[model samples]
Target: MHTRYGSINREMLIKRSPGWRWIDWEELSHYRDLLYFLTIRGIRARYAQSVMGVSWAIIQPLATTLIFTVVFGNFAKLSSDGAPYLLFSFLAILPWTYFSSTITDASVSLVQNSLLITKVYFPRMFIPLASALGKWLDFSIGLLVLVVLLFYFKAAPGWELIFLPILLIILFIVSVALGLLFSAMSVQYRDVKHAMPFIIQLLMYLAPVVYSTHTIPLAWQKWYVLNPMVGVVEGFRAIFLHHPMPWNWITTGCGVSIVLFILSAAYFRRMERGFADMA
Candidate 1:
């Protein structure tokens, strides 16, 4: 059927493709407004009824930073790579918080929207994609706290600051990649919702969030960088904490994220055919 907006006319075609189908870029672009609305809706739904609302974004990382400072910095004496332990942990926590929270919401996105999924023909990918996008509001607010820390420490990022956006983009892709995989799987198996928090908790220890990469044994460092967040968290410190950029880790992690995104997108599309039935 044809949809008319003002004088412009657009046709949306719906049909079944027999085999596995990849993302329909053009089709998604046509539905861009839906993605925007969903993203906004998610942001509002998360903060609407809360008393503190957006302030929770600033509080979460600060609270985590305080706990880590007391336990790891004071007692255990974990290396913060020479920066103040508080700033170091907060920088890592900023991205990690975004990554974890996005995944948590995205994983159950399809299941939560089962009614819409069963009734609609839009790209299912948007559900998780919107979740990822919505969490950036929290991340952006957290950045303000990061700036305050930067000023308090009198630390300045040198030329390496230019790479921050690239690092964040890679981080975003990593979140979306896993989000797609888990969101699709959760539609078929309700257990994914239960297991996700535990998985994300374990993943935090795997990444160099509370400690520096220097703690990793030299021999295992190469293999450890394969986890994308290792690079992202380390890169975040390198830029904000004024440490040397770890290009090897960052490049390796970026490559892994890209490959994972392709595989996850393929799997999500392959499973898309059954989402309405299963959801």
Candidate 2:
């Protein structure tokens, strides 16, 4: 009886020792319910006290697209790769908004939840994961608006429509990758919070959100696709406008996202060892 009791005690100790793992799938699954509630709470809390509520999601991209249409499309007379300038900018804005919002919220998630982080033993990664996942609601609302614009323009997608899912997956990977890295750094150094906005603003221009990638000179085109969102935005336009797929850009984005995800996950896990102490 004592031997059996000792064996049970050992198993309990082993189960409880969830050390800093890079990506512990089993441990995350064990706490899946926590992740679910955290994601739901983030979604509700996001719009609960807002004046416009969920409409803010649609308004942001729509407003930005209108400004770009006026300035870049009309004034500058930029190329839209043959698609309507309004539709072109809106397509890029959808993913850019989602990517920006996710990382922005996630960058402060750890600090915001310091109380819980210090007191809880669950996976710390869940905090940022919840932030990243919550933005899907906003993305879906924007996607609905995109559908309406597609009809208004009478555009039709072809077999290339199948590539959309892959592009979306890469977009998600890029967002979460940066989200994890920024959140981890934000915990130890508050400067990440202040610098994040400028970083995001810089990235927006870098990724061709306000202009067409075609406008990028042939000399710079190879280096330009290094920004993962280049592929994502151009892929969206290709699908909606029935243009040929930008295979090189898309593949480069996939490779870059994978590398970033691996590095960010490792860095996040390493940094999390001191999170409770830092919090």
Model 2 poorest 10 in a row by lDDT = 1-10
Clashes of each: 0, 0
Per-prediction TM-score, please? Answer: 0.94, 0.93
Which predicted model would earn the best TM-score?
1
Candidate 1 lDDT, 180-262, residue by residue in tens: 99999999989999999899999999999999999999999999999999999999999987788999999999999999999
lDDT of 2 by residue, 28-118 (tens): 8878999999999999998998889999999999999999999999999998887799999999999999999999999999999999999
Which predicted model would earn the best lDDT?
1
Clashing residue pairs, backbone N/CA/C < 3 A, model 2: none
lDDT over C-alpha atoms for residue 245 of model 1: 93
